[model samples]
Target: MKLAVIGLGMASKPHLAALKLLADQIEVVGLYSRSESRRAAMAAETGWPAFDSLQAVANSDAQVVIVITPPNARAELVQTLGAAGKAILMEKPVERDLARAKALVETCEGFGVPLGIVLQHRYRAGAEALADLMASGRAGKVLMARVSLPWWRDQGYYDTPGRGTLDMDGGGVLITQAIHVLDLMLSLAGPVAEVMALTGKTPLHQMETEDFAAAGLRFENGAVGSVVATTAAYPGGAETLELECTHVALKLEAGALTLHWRNGQTETVGEVTGTGGGGDPMDFPCDWHRDLITDFAARVQAGQAPRVSGRDALRVHRLIDAIERSARTRAIAQVEAEA
Candidate 1:
């Protein structure tokens, strides 16, 4: 399979690395970025050709296209690819708004094309192991869970004019960072049925969106959860995404999954890292992108849906949308409408 990557940002780097990792089965032939310098930089990193326009990029020999574009432009780009008859792997928060997400989903489904969203956390070894444990009933009833992402983003990070603006980024830390943890939370604790949330913005940052978001959640499986995500923390430690169940507490700390169980079992665990990016950020204990791309390629080759399907992405998207509404109304919001 040949792949093409659109957008050259911090996130796209991992995708490029993953493509290299999957070289045995796939090759990334070309890259597309609006920024000429970014295209040059990526071309230097990976010896792939870079193009300036989406049309030229789409017309390349790649059978698969991975879009890591901004939220606002994703739907249109996906639609264009859909019309062009190209398979796509898109980056998440499918859109900054729910309506656009729905339209994009409809467009893909209408075209009967294979469409996927990059919720790569689900592909991590620790996540897979814990998910197996949950399915095996080792986690018991899963009474409650909490997800906290208190990472720091200096004002300079959002100093750019468009940073953190609702129209661009969609929302703040909850939408950007916590959404990954939220997907994991949903997987572990089951789907959230309802939520009541409060969002806040401090003068510590000069951005149009909220810097903090707190939500109270009731899961469909009778589990309760609380989420507090913020980009306002100072002197941040590791970018932490932690979860606790009735019988197990799991966290990804310093790039390892730390599991603490009721019977006094506490240890860091993960699966064998496969042949993938071999250094620094790539060599980190967990290479989410490599595993995800490999798995997706395998599934696509076998004519099966990806483990993380587009519909699953839609569910998580709905939950995020509900959280936003609950925060805006300062009232409980149901994740699903009444049957």
Candidate 2:
């Protein structure tokens, strides 16, 4: 499958490396970036054609287009490719604003195009195994879930122009940093029914977005959850994500899977650390990206619906949107009907 990955950000490097593993199956035909120097550098490194325009990239031999641009430009880019009749794999948050997110979904629907959001956390081994446990009734019942993260980002991180801006990066902690785990939270429990959140800028960071965030979420399955994510935590080592259910507790330090459950009626569950990547949430199954791309390509080949279609991405975006709205109004917001 020929693919084009638009945007040369931090996440793009892994995708490029992953494609190297499946060199026989996938070929990156095009690369797109705004930074002339970085774009030239990426092209020189990959030995791929560099295009000054996204439309040219869309029209190239790349049957699959991966939009890794900022959330603000994602919708327009997706819509553009959809117009060109291309299958798309986009980075998270769908769009910078809810209206644009909804518009992208609607446009894709009208065009009958295939879209996949890069919520790669859903592709993690730990998340998949735990989801299986919960679904198989081995976890008894989900009584509660807690998604917490105290990740660190240096002051230099937000120094970039669009680093923490609402118009470009979307929301700060939850939308940008914690969204993968949060999406995994929703994927584990169920779609969020409502969310009441508080977000603000506590530290004098280099940007205007919030540095601290906390939220209370209610899952539609009657499971209650709490979320706390911040960049203000000092001496940041590893961010933590713990999900507790009726009789099971699954914890991931960074992204590795760990499970603790009641052995007997009152017995304590044993301790063991799971394999797979634990630091970068983006590093999951080696073939996860390939699986995602192949799935989209297969759908495009068969003229069928994609597993992570644009509508699916819109649902994730809705949760992100509701989180931001919930923060502003300091009230719970509902997830809208899927289009």
Candidate 3:
């Protein structure tokens, strides 16, 4: 498929790498961003041609357009892409909040274009195994789940204007960093029905949004779970999710999965891989991104549904919204009904 990328920033590194690896499946014909300097850097660095203007990108022959801009700057860009009849693969959180996210999704739908989101954590080998088991009903009903994102980000990381602020990147920990794992968790365990949360900022980072969030989740399937996501941990550790099912118990940490069966036998699948949960946000490999892009390109050609479509991504966004609501009201908050 012919493809192009917009908003060539720090977040575009893995994507650029992924596009290179996926050269056979996707031809990255052009790159664009508001800053000519950034476009120059990307063109010089990756040898991908730079589009001089948004109109140039819209007028191009690229079938798939990857929009990797910050959360605060997406609506108008997506609108333009939609009008240009370009299928979009956007970076996560869709927008600053759920309402904006929904409108963005509608904009793409109005163009009758497929919109995919880059929640690549769901493409990990371990996550795939667990997801297959869940769909197969071999693991039985998940009775309980435990999720933790003990991530760290030095104050300097958030020192950039609009880094941790509500106005720019949305929320601090949950929306920006933890959203990957949160999306992975929801994809594995299904939708959350309700959440009671306590969220606030620790002194470690002077930010506008919460750096720490702890919540109790009640899944629509009658499964229960706990979530502790934060960036306050020093030198962050690997994020983890544990699911205790009727047939067996599974633990997925980093990129590996361990199954503890009823017969006292245990087996592990996948090798441990860097999660980028620590200091360096781009520390992880680009393999997962490659896999996700591979699927997306195939689906785009086949005229099929995306593995992580924009509307489907709303599951995690709704869960995050409920968490913040409960954090504020100190009461149980229900996940919003999906359309």
lDDT of residue 28 for candidate 3:
91
What's model 1's lDDT at 137?
82
Structure candidate 3, residue pairs in collision: none
**Whole-model Cα lDDT per candidate?**
0.75, 0.72, 0.91
Give the per-residue lDDT of model 2 (tens digit) for 1-339: 788888998767667776777678777887898887888999999887788888788778787888888887776677688888878888777776678777877787777777778776665555566667778987776778787666666676777678878888876877787777777776667787888888888654667888788888887888888888777665344555677777767776654667776664422222233212223434334455666666666777787877666666666677777878888887778866555
lDDT of 1 by residue, 147-236 (tens): 776666778768766678888888877777677778877877778899999898988888888888888888898878888877777654
Q: How accurate is candidate 2 locally (lDDT)?
A: 0.72
TM-score of each: 0.89, 0.87, 0.98
Q: Model 3 over residues 1-339: C-alpha lDDT tens digits?
A: 899999887899899999998887789999999998989988998988999988898899999999999999998888888999999999998888999899999998989999999999888899999898889988888899999999998988899878988888889899998888889888888899999999999999988999999999999999999999999998999999999999999999998999998779898988788887788888999999999989998999999988899999988899999999999999999999888
- The TM-score, computed over Cα atoms with residue i paired to residue i, of candidate 2 is 0.87
* Pairwise lDDT winner, candidates 1 and 2: 1
Model 3 clash number: 0
| Full candidate order by TM-score, most accurate first | 3, 1, 2
Worst 10 residues of 3 by lDDT: 270-279
Instruction: Give residue 314's lDDT in candidate 3 (0 to 100).
Output: 89
What is the TM-score of candidate 1? Answer: 0.89
- Listed per model in order, the count of residue pairs whose N, CA or C atoms clash below 3 Å is 0, 0, 0
